[model samples]
Target: KATVDFQPNYDGSQEEPTVLPSAFPNFLVNGGTGIAVGLATNLAPHNLGEVIDGICAQIDNPEITLPELMQLIKGPDFPVSCEIRGIRGIEEYFRTGRGSMRLRGKVEIEENENGKSLIVIREVPYGVNRAVLQERIAELVNEKILTGISGMRDLSDEETRIEIELKRDARPQVVVAQLFKLTSLETSFSVNMLAIHQNRPKQFSLKEAIDAYIEHRRDVIIRRTRFLLGKAEERAELLEAFLLALGHLDDFIKIIRDSKNRDEARERLGSYKFSTATAEKLGILIRSQAAVQGDRYVFSERQVNAILELRLYQLTGMEQDKVKGEYDGILIDIKDLLDILAREVRVLTIIKDELRVIRDKYATPRKCPILAEAGEIAMEDLIANDAMIVTLSHRGYVKRTPASEYRLQGRGGKGLKGMETRATGKDAPDDFIEHLFSVQAHDYLLFFTNTGRVYVERVFELPEGSRTAMGRSIKNVLDLKPEEKIAAMLRLERSTDENGHDNTFREGAGYVFFATRSGKVKKTSLNDFRNYRKAGLTAINLEEGNDLIGVNLTSGEDEIVLVTRDGMSIKFTEGVYKKPQGELAEGEEPVEEDSGEEDSADEEGRPQIRPQGRATAGVTGIRLRKDDYVVGMAIASEETMLLVASENGLGKRTSFSSYRALRRGGLGVKTLNVTDKTGKVVNAVAVTEQDELMLMTSTGQSIRIRVSEIRETGRVAQGVKLLTLKEGEKLQDISLVIPDGEDSPGDDTSVDASEGESGSVTEETTE
Candidate 1:
């Protein structure tokens, strides 16, 4: 034992224990935050049971790896019933003793009495005061920094219940995500492990902290065993003295009666000696010590005092047996305590056993669940990856509804209203749905503007809406230039091959085809658009007074089709191959003409139009007559039928093989017979009978017509009226809904993946 002085007041007090004899390692269970001279510790608390399990595991296997240790102690377990998002911080903190983890309040979406969605906060992040958080939310709502929240109220009692009422048009999922982003509903806990060791402060890793506790536990167990053994042995000796006195009780009583005083009795008793043979004869167990010499047992001053002080009742016949039994029990206790002190493993086993008792009585279930990633609450985490029907209006409003909302309808049926029209305060005409898209929520949405810039985002980023809702302004979603309009969009998983070619879209399509209103066509390597800036990237360079009208993902070898407003259409090969390239990718074949031989070409075949740079003016694919303009372009497939729609709502499906292939830069033959009544050809795409056609008009009306209903006809056939457009409405665009598994680098199709799966992001890196 070491002596130390601690003065809490003017009066001094001295005490010492050398080191504390703790019952268990409480440092990890009840973690602390404190600071001293140049040292501090901000330890996160852990579950008692998990911590004990980990300690036992370490005791069982000192060589356990961090991953294995983590199996027992998953991470810090906060007392609050909130969510702990992501395990990355847990891993970092365990390995390095310094990291952070995200925490979020639990929220539920419910319908109120008025059928409007309401948000309820059930459990908040650790260390956050409910009152303060509610006050903060109230301030934000009052100031209008957080929109869509119409009202809020607190119904807190034993458990938290903060209800936030939403506007009729607010999306519950988006509002919940925004609350996490803007409030203490989401927070983080950081760990920095510092501790006192051997009277000095030290920074510690998780494993180091565990080991230190174990070593301290070892010291405590050993010291306690020594103290216990000493006391047990000391009492066993006193009992031995009592039993020996009982062997000569009458003589001892006579001596005590004859003694002149207590001191005399003690002196006489100390000087007396009993034969060792007497102890054996009486069946008494005696430990030979300083009080015993040679073969005789001479009473020590301590033993004499103990014998003299014994009460008459302890010397009675019935009590003698009790004294003997007590002595025997103490002897066993001494032996056990001695054994415990002798073996380190036994001490550890005892420690483990006691810890189990604590665990069984006090441990609770973990309150926090860990997520897998370390980013903010992403929509990808909440929304399903199912296909959605996204509609865009002429005035730049956009929204996505579940695709199941639209049922199968026959051709020539006037479709239900998909979006409500809203006029601008500046006297701009009321808007109508101009673009209809079928895309998986997780697909990459590339937005190309008439100004030649392109922006990319996930399909789920579009605001979710109910049927007939006009939706949020596109300006709030995308950073667009003045006078810019969304000309086209492609939902493709973008990636580049080792050769820096685009390969994710339609199997092996490695280029992007761009068409302008002036009959200009360009094909640039698709990889060139990878990893664009948030401000967007230049997709195509347009001539003065020209705008981009069509954009399609293309295979370098697919046939290119350009249709003009003046009824001119052309089919030309993207490239010419005299023979197979030195080597081709597996499951791929070289592009060849219709002769069915790799080296042969037919008279109808056309040469491949070489790709052009992004900034350069593309070569003319058609010679448009005065007042004529290119309206649509597509990567045509001979196996698929091409559907062409006109401004006057007339459309026809024709076998792509019916059209003769033409060379680039020419006055191509007419695919649709256009007259004043039929109007100009507006849009065309390669589609199949199983696919559905989404045709939108200039006045924002849309119709979904079954491709099978419109039977294939010969090229140059006069189109039948597909839909009766009201007064001024004319066809503006066409989107083909090919089922999943059909689009690839070679298939030349568009739209949607599997339904009911959450969206995934395709990350592309470029040098």
Candidate 2:
């Protein structure tokens, strides 16, 4: 260690060097952490070879910028193999010596031969204790804050490896995301590149640190060169004196013999004369070419003392030749040393060559992998974008399958098995598929319950399965109150803003029209319930015995049709509201209805009413009998046909023109003839000629028929047999499945039919 300065020991008996002169930048190579009086420092370690290479580069070009130097240095290299996200933090640290970066453990999902997957964490960030990390993860799992982990174990031995076993059917990626959010698997590293330079502590940028190392190496080269030069000059002078005596051997022997003591002999040799050959060589040997000083060889005191102390064994002829050769080599060395002291470029060259050697011997490959773009993975990234067939069973079970599972078949063909497994619930039900439609997984689904509450869930959150697999019960997903069930489900696509946002459309821009089982109807803006809570949000204020049954999205210009179980259907144009209706502006009292303009009916002789707000009980949508309640609701247009089906497998299609437009609170049309031969109306849907219908029975049998094959007739005509049920079976529910990329058929119009008309019915058979 080169002593910068000395300090007394504890008892003042010894001195110690304050700092050692390091050959390389120790602060940057093996980074340090320390806490001083009011400040602290944390520097990340770097690769040894990279540090050496950077020093050499700075020595070659002192004016290089930080960014240019960074190209050679890259970024910090740690011992543990982890991931460092992005270059922004590293660049800032190198430029100003202070910044922070995100570091994540290197993790991979491995699957064994049995198809069981394990989350394996192979490495962690620098300075992180593996035992502490394992403990933290276990604690979170025990607390149930992090889920899907069945068990966790610390398998670290020679290398760090933590294995997290997942339960069967658990989503691995989703669990990993949760782990990152809840545990210390991902963390940040703060960088503070502070060091002592020129006897003072100071912050150093990357380029400045490299420059400091270069200066230290330069000083070492100069001091060493000067010391060697001094020794070489002294040795050269003594060699010249000895060579002169050898050339005049006869005089040298006589002088030594005649002298009384060694001092007298040394004096005699110093004044001895030599031949012209030795004189010429002496002039060239001394740095200054002074003449031989009047035929006498003059030596300094150092050379005289050296000759007096010479041993007898070193006085042989072979030894004399060896001394002559050493003298010549010393002359060359002295000249080169002088050159090094005189030129700064030569010193720099020496520093570069030595650094290169160190780099070649010690450099290693990078351990941390830096990403270009870094941030937390978003929820959208984990969801696959595909058109999925979402099926909701009558028994409250739900699942999603790819749309490719079902192929188009001719009219009246036996439908492909929609759901192959049975669902168990109260009464051991067969769980016929009640609702089946295609929508993208990213879309939002609003589940309107019979209790007038709405629950929102993303399509992707539903359990995904194959066509034959029975899915999880919906009760596990939604927190439904006692005896509550989803009555109607609506799919809301993403709104357009280039970047999609849900329901960004303004209030009153669109409407969600609601219809209840007690023939109550209401219209509320689509944006009114956008901010729903997990438990659910109030969709409408229901009366004591009424429950929500039908919900549809409309632009406020379309026509609506409501059908009852007793074969009654009503069609009305969506009404517009003028005055304040529900929960009036803050503290206003409720106003009594005027009923003044002499209440009158519309052109079709049906009662007309103004629209009301969401909180108010709805106006009458249809007048129903005591034993009847609305069974189906749809938006109708002229080009579309209404497919009505009964419980005993009788079905028919009547053109939407067959229904006449009425005002709100009208129940004045027959959609199908309900009799002993044909049971009560089970389902009714507005469909296009190109669409297909799925008919399900109480016995778990289903059939697909095209809308064009069902003979279209007037609303009063009895329908034909659509499905051949067994002796004890009846139709349970029916759904209209639209093919992809087909425009909805029809123009807005309505037609009315007379009641009590009998018609012939034929039976259609399908295996």
Candidate 3:
């Protein structure tokens, strides 16, 4: 809290007092509360020097208004970055006194070595954080508020980076100036007069308040001046009326000296209105008389002396001087009031001027006539320029062409029919008519007539070798007549592959036709064969057009096969076929023939074929065919079994116990190895109880075994015992048998005897 003493005048006097601890200056103590009371105002403290200067400037030249003061003085100089707002009522407040202050941040700038610059901010306004700033920036980016700034590149604890890629070259200072001028970085303060207050619950309009205050002050001055003037006029009128009523001095004297009361004294002068001289004498007498509470008139010594000394005429002059003094005071007061009113009016005028200047500086007009006119003039200026390409649109359709190129307006001026019609005569025949014209791929084509008639014959052929025309329309060329077509003049350029064969070019055919612009037939040729082939030339179609289809081969004879679309084939031999040969290619190999019934040693020195089968209980022995031989044997339970060898392997073994486990049709026991005369193992054998076996030599040759008969051995063998048969606790020697039979035998033996046990044997049985 601070105290300030204000003395209206520099010289301190008893009458001109000093105001101690003025509430006006101490308004900052409680942060300056303000109340707008109707026309009156209460503006809080501003900077002392600025305020004083502002007031003095206004007083010296009353044209200085509050807004002007604001422009000149601004606000308090705070150490921290701050913004003052809500001061819209400042003019009225200065006139009456009240306003508000809001604080905010200041924007700064920093530059880097890369010639890049960034806007820096040290502090933010009260109640605003870094997040708020970022959010605001993001919102602006989305809304396209901040132009030239692409977006916020990075935002962290210390700083934020905004991406400002300038569209054009701009100086750093110029860019910064633009940022401050157009964007919110520098200033985002708004003066809202609608701040709440205790006394003025609602907002105050400055104009309304100032006008009301001025009117009220004017009325006060007028009323005070009128009252003083009315009093002086009444005094002058009374004295003049009294002078007219008084007749003589002696009559007035009798009334003034002998009257017990003012009413009696007034009656005694009856019908004798005081003459100017008599009224003067009465005025002196009245002046000498002291005012009494009752009927009695008392006179002081000074009054008695004044009565004795008074001349009747002199009294009149004195009375006139008193009236004149009252008029003079009123006049002086009126002049002072007028001066104050003039000062206020001048202040208001200055405020208006300041507002006008501020508005002109900040609130610029939206539309610039110069900018708008530039665009209009540029558009009108478009004409023939070599570098400029023009797109002309008819209806919604547009075509691009060079600035001065000519294009075909359709026959009826409907659509693009041919090239450079403007260069050609419109009366030319359709054959000679070209609807499209170009200079370097800039096509000029007419689409419609002025009468809106569409010319169906209109065609637009894109220039050849145009990369941009890859998927564009080629409908114009394809509509040409058979012989008149450009295709008719096109020859098939044959190419050969690495294999010395010509590339296929069967597209052209007699039935295929190309047309010219006039629908006339152009030249006709075999080049159309390529076109026909691409149109899905089938075998039937190929045959129908046989004269158009030809084959050319460089090497091997190729029979021309015409395959129809439905997969049916027609073959035609065009040249002789030459055979290719080699001995190995014939699949021939040497093999040794077998001698009838010869006992030959296998690769392992043992007989290859084996015979084995089930025998009846009463049958003590069995026989085998010449093709069959003994291999091995086994016994189980009450059954005695024999072993036989065959081309494949050992034979079957059977017992009452074995038969119970496996019926007679099941596999029998057999040996896996065979013995020679020296009792050496020559081969390994495997057999089934179903009379089939496999014989494998030690040398790895294998053959199938089949059983024709089964036999039981009464004793063990003397030379080599092929296998020991076991029955319960007893061991028995089993003899192998070979059967002699007539069987068809000369066939490649890939079949295994074990396959027969599985019911897979294929053989003829004889009785």
**Candidate 1 global lDDT:** 0.72
Model 2 per-residue lDDT tens digits across residues 26-63: 78888989998877889999988878877777777888
Indicate which candidate wins on TM-score: 1
lDDT of 3 by residue, 1-767 (tens): 11222354655553332323221222321123334555332333234444334433543555555555555444434323444333333333433434443443444444445645455455555345556566766665567655545434434355433444432233333444454444444343222333333224444443333233333334444444445545544444443333332323455576578878755654444433323344344442222222321333333333333333445674575665664455456445545544544575643443344434544454322110111010011211112222111121111112333322222111111111122212123453221211111122211222222111111111122223211112212222122211111111111223445875443333222221111111111112223233231111211111111111111111112222221111111121222312223321111121122212233222342322111111101110112223332222122222223332222222222222211121111111222222222122121111234433222222212122333322322111211111211121111111111221223232332333234333221231110
Question: Candidate 3 regions off by >4 Å?
Answer: 1-31, 34-44, 47-69, 76-201, 205-209, 230-251, 254-261, 267-767
C-alpha lDDT score of every prediction, in listed order = 0.72, 0.70, 0.29
TM-score of 1: 0.51
If both were scored by lDDT, which would come out higher, candidate 2 or candidate 3?
2
- Judged by lDDT, which candidate is best? 1
Off by over 4 Å in 1: 1-11, 14-20, 275-277, 284-288, 375-767
Counting clashing residue pairs in each candidate, in order, gives 10, 7, 90
Clashing pairs in 1: 86-371, 385-757, 385-758, 506-744, 506-745, 507-744, 507-745, 508-745, 509-745, 575-608
What TM-score, over all chains together, does every model reach?
0.51, 0.48, 0.20
